[model samples]
Target chain A: MTRILADRAARLLDFLWSGWAGLAALALLFACWQAGHETWGDFILPDPLATLGATWSLAISSESRGLLLLTAQRALAGFTLAAFSGAVIGIIAGYAPAVMRLARPLLTVVLGVPPIAWIVLTMMWFGTSGATVAATILISATPVVFVAAAEGIASRDRGLGTMAEVFRYGALGRFWFIDLRQAAAPLFPALALALGTSFKVAVMAEMLANAGGVGGALARARAMLDVPQALAWVVLAVIALVVVEYGLIRPMQAEIEGWRRAAQPWGVKK
Target chain B: MSAALELHRIGHAYFGQSVLNSIDLQIAPGEVVALVGPSGSGKSTLAHIAAGLVEPREGRVTPGYARHAMIFQEPRLLPWATAAQNIGFALRRAKLPRRLRPARVAEAARLAELEPQDLAKYPVELSGGMRQRVAIARALAVRPDFIFFDEPFTALDVALKRRMQDLVIAAAEEAQFAALFITHDLVEALRIAHRIAVLDLRGRGIAGLRILPGDPGARDEATTFALRQRFLTEDPLFRHIHDVDERRRP
Candidate 1:
């Protein structure tokens, strides 16, 4: 039908339009790379197209796919665990100011310690295993989610609680439906940030600890002084980050916040 | 039948300053009593006391009947809930069977003049009038024996206010629900209330009560306007109210 075709066209337009800003940023990065390429002459930085071709080949290869998968799996596992624990503790802390005050110092200390330091400590304990990579990511990302969820819970609309009470909605019903709905808004942006952190920490841990992932592959490329290949692995990791964030997280945000679409200027009522 | 609600010698104070002093009022079954007062006359505090929202320091409320509800000045709808879901929330509290909730919500929505398409929209998606209608629908969904109207239509425009008042009057008649309507608008009080109970601004308790003559919710705009003019001339509170209005009307 013409309607179906029109809908598909509109969706395609939306998809392309959403990527325009990212494309512009990538163009800027490429320009910087071109300047360096012109200066170093294919030894230090290499041509952007050479790195793009290397990334394309890496994308096609089974070994590189496995390395990408390993890194993704570790990052996601750590993020899931952190999200669960952080939301629980953060919600409790939000309701109890004493708990938040007590935890503030500890949270600052944990967040201030760099991911590299956590990687070193985790490596000493887990010794170049996937566990070290997961541990490092959990440490680096959990605090961001916790702080966001806590702040969200603390600042939720107070009228909703009273409204729920007037309706005589049970305690559990009020908490799960009303309280959680308000908290989820801010928590989601923090979650996106944490997911990015998880990826960064995972790759860093893999390279430093010799864990088998994209970071390990990047280490191999670095030792061989294959500039394009090294850039190719970096590009592949970034591609993974962009794909997960845009593909998974963005759609969920759109669905939950769909009510805002109605707030847009309608111009004329239907 | 027993009285629907009774407030016996209710007295309250915030930080030792008396807001309500030995306030007493009663609502018979199916009666609509409007509580009228100027700002800071403890009209809201008395309404809250009657609804058991805030406990009266000196007396008590006897909510004799089951399934009472309140419609506040603000819509106070849960933003996350769709219109139908918000109505369904009230049905749940009314203890309708889970399977029957959707039907009852739809029926209440019909009574409140909410369209079916609006049922799926969240509070943020609804207009100011539509959101108030949703709140009205939620209050009426339970088919309650009593409802407290705490100046619920103040935010609405004149047309919307009339519409909402009509809905409340219709619901009150059809369900025979007792209501304690609170407002500063004398015309609105006259429109929806069977009798007006005026709260004294210079003091803490009710000053007078006036009963109106007519079938409630009947579209007698001329009759209501006549009664409103009489109130402006005769009622002390309304005369005081008119003096303020007289100064402002240029």
Candidate 2:
């Protein structure tokens, strides 16, 4: 028990330390943004400070915060739907090669149709509502998760399955203990990608459909030619993406794949 | 008493090509039998069949033991789990209470010569030999009445292989369990098995069976070497044991 607690503590520390690197990367992006603002002048690209000021003002307002929350809710709801259904179908297809083969063409077709096209289609179907935004995110994000999960399961070590069989682990036990554990290594990354897609698609759908969200706010800023406000909203959307990815997805990945960290030597940890 | 395992006329083929045919073998309780064959000679297929990992295309496998475990050529340890967790996984099948599982894992780790510190390490953290040790501990933790070894130590260095064979001999003696140990190495078979059954090159059947002198662990190094030498040089049944048929799967 003490060992587990100590390990968890160590991982927490490691994660916190890695945030310094993230901060450095963000600083580099800020430098690039400052250079671009100077090069293009205030008309085309707003200075970093002006955008920050706009971001702070927007953040302090209750209406803009509600809009951000609404967009996050729509994205998360669509992501949850996609993740659950994609994982289930993918796992079943993974165990059955014929099913996987049949799903491959369909996955390609779904992937080939852009998120914008889905937004247009869904806007027509749901008529410019939250459901339209959610449906677009769902269609755009599920393929990535499905493909990753299928590949993960398809490529698992068959030797482990035989070992489980020898030990008399039932079908359910083997699936739970061996198959799912192996599949998780690939599944987590796909989930992260799908989440990013969900947010992007949600915002795109909201903008195209003229729904009320961060995307809708951005549309209004564009109509009024409020460049700094539009950039600020974009920044807010990115911050939300980073929070969901690092805060939720990464921690779950670290917990599931702790053994991978053990495999690395001390110098390789960072 | 009934035999611990009985494989009657076991026949199996992959993709319409027969790899094992009419193979008959039996192991009495507390006996260690080595099935020796060349690469791609269906030794592993037969072991898998007897262990119920594969369904025989044309025969019956009657396992009289209470429970059985297997140690494959690779460690086959769950890379995501710690060594202790891997061993504890097998104890789950034994239906030991959850509270007692740690102690049982520790006991089996000790039996496999795994140290306390090593039990907390994942399989990827351990060396190749240590990973195989974890696999052995996993098998031992189940307290199986029978065990199947499908070339469990072929990947190890010579010294490591000897140490692993000694560990198995010691564990088998202490537990008095029956095992079907499949190997291509005659010395390994001589050192660990009470009886060595030579499998035919073409997978027709068990070519012959030889009962070795003395018990498995009691045999000296010199005795094992000489017996292996005699079997390789003089025994006609072992002529194909070293022969590799290039066409078949290794």
Worst 10 residues of 1 chain A by lDDT: A261-270
Q: Write model 1 residue lDDT over B201-227, tens digit each, in one string.
A: 643567788888976677398999899
What TM-score does structure 2 among the candidates reach? 0.97
**DockQ class, candidate 2:** medium
Candidate 2 docking DockQ:
0.65
- Tell me the tens digit of each residue's lDDT in model 1 across A43-67: 8888999999999999999989999
Q: Which pairs of residues collide in candidate 1?
A: none
**lDDT tens digits by residue: candidate 2, A151-177:** 889999988988898888999999999
The runs of at least 3 residues in candidate 1 whose Cα sits more than 4 Å from the true structure, single-residue gaps closed, are A1-40, A104-106, A124-127, A266-270, B15-18, B55-58, B97-99, B200-203, B218-226, B229-233, B236-250
Which residue pairs collide, candidate 2?
none
